[model samples]
Target: MRNPSLAPPINRGLILRDFPKAEDTPTVQDTNENDTNWVALMVRVRDQRDKTAFAALFTHFAPRIKGFLINSGADAPLAEECAQDVMTTLWHKAAQFDPARASVATWIFTIARNRRIDMLRRQRRPEPDDLTWGPAPEPDQADVLALQQETASLSVAMAALPAPQRDLIEKAYFKDLSQSEIAKITGLPLGTIKSRLRLALDRLRHAMK
Candidate 1:
């Protein structure tokens, strides 16, 4: 849990993009340059001991990691705690990331996902796949199975999404990441991330349809 006073100030001026924003056309980038960059960055951190580069990655992804958890339904404190864990793990395990196995967004999202699961350790039951962390509602077995199926379908759909489309969504929805966060992570202009996100959402809508 995060100290009430120590939370990084979330920018109120910031507005999160809607998911499946276009929902009419889901298009993947031919390749994710961000992933390519992360691969190189990971290698640099692991092999050369570049604190600057590693720190850059941490600064860029931390907020996105926080946003992703909040968007996934964690409260403010839990989200902040989760983000710290993600960054700490990244610092320790830079060598573990391989672009060949996953895109940057995919890999980070997986980490956040796993971290969220770990948080459930102290809870009596792991939160349902639906990820609602409020009061425990007794869901029937059929409802539970349906929720699992939905998560599985979304998970598969998430993997199949094109890099460009998925990138925006991952930063936005999965990471509850913002345009600014996306900009920082990929070193793209804010306008570029926003406009591109609109297009990507459209493509995702189409593909997921």
Candidate 2:
């Protein structure tokens, strides 16, 4: 493994830009210094159980994981909690990181993905057996095409929305908050929140067609 001290400083901007960049970004050799190989850092963590290496890894990934969870519909507090859990798991399971199979970012984000799913499932109340969901139906060609088209249109429409509407939509869907919750968070009336959502959905639907 390469010495951390000799590695180039890790670019925090690149690390946050995309997880794939983690595989390509250099790691910091010193916990106090900012340059090193990520793969090497993981190896150090695995072979020596190096706390510095683990700290370096945490510094790089924790906030990104939290943002990812938040973007995937988790609340801020839940995202923070899940991100911490993911980092702790990475520290303990560093030996399992396989550079050949995936980059360090991919591996870490996989853990984040799984953790988010588990958190969401836990948040959902258990339903009676009779109300339990069954296997989902496979999408047919037309349905698949229509869904794809709608997704593309919605993307465009969302980008075109005024800042206020866009922010509301993000809070409602991206943050997975209800209208009431969004109203409370934004200090808007419930009626105003509902009206904005309706307008946004209308524009999105029009764009989809």
Candidate No. with top TM-score: 1
lDDT of 2 by residue, 1-209 (tens): 99987999664321111221222323311321222266668768877899898898888889989998988878999899999999999988776654433346657877887787679876533433631222112213343233323333333334444566667666664456776666543432223224433544454346446
Which parts of model 2 are misplaced by more than 4 Å? 1-36, 123-209
What tens digits encode model 1's per-residue C-alpha lDDT throughout 1-209? Answer: 98966998654232223123223323322223343466567657766778888787788788989987887778989999889998878778665544333345556777788887667544333543521232122323343233223333334445554566557755564555767666544432234334433543354346445
Worst 10 residues of 2 by lDDT: 13-22
- Give model 1 RMSD, 1 decimal: 18.7
Q: Give me the displacement of residue 137 in model 1, in angstroms.
A: 48
lDDT of each: 0.55, 0.57
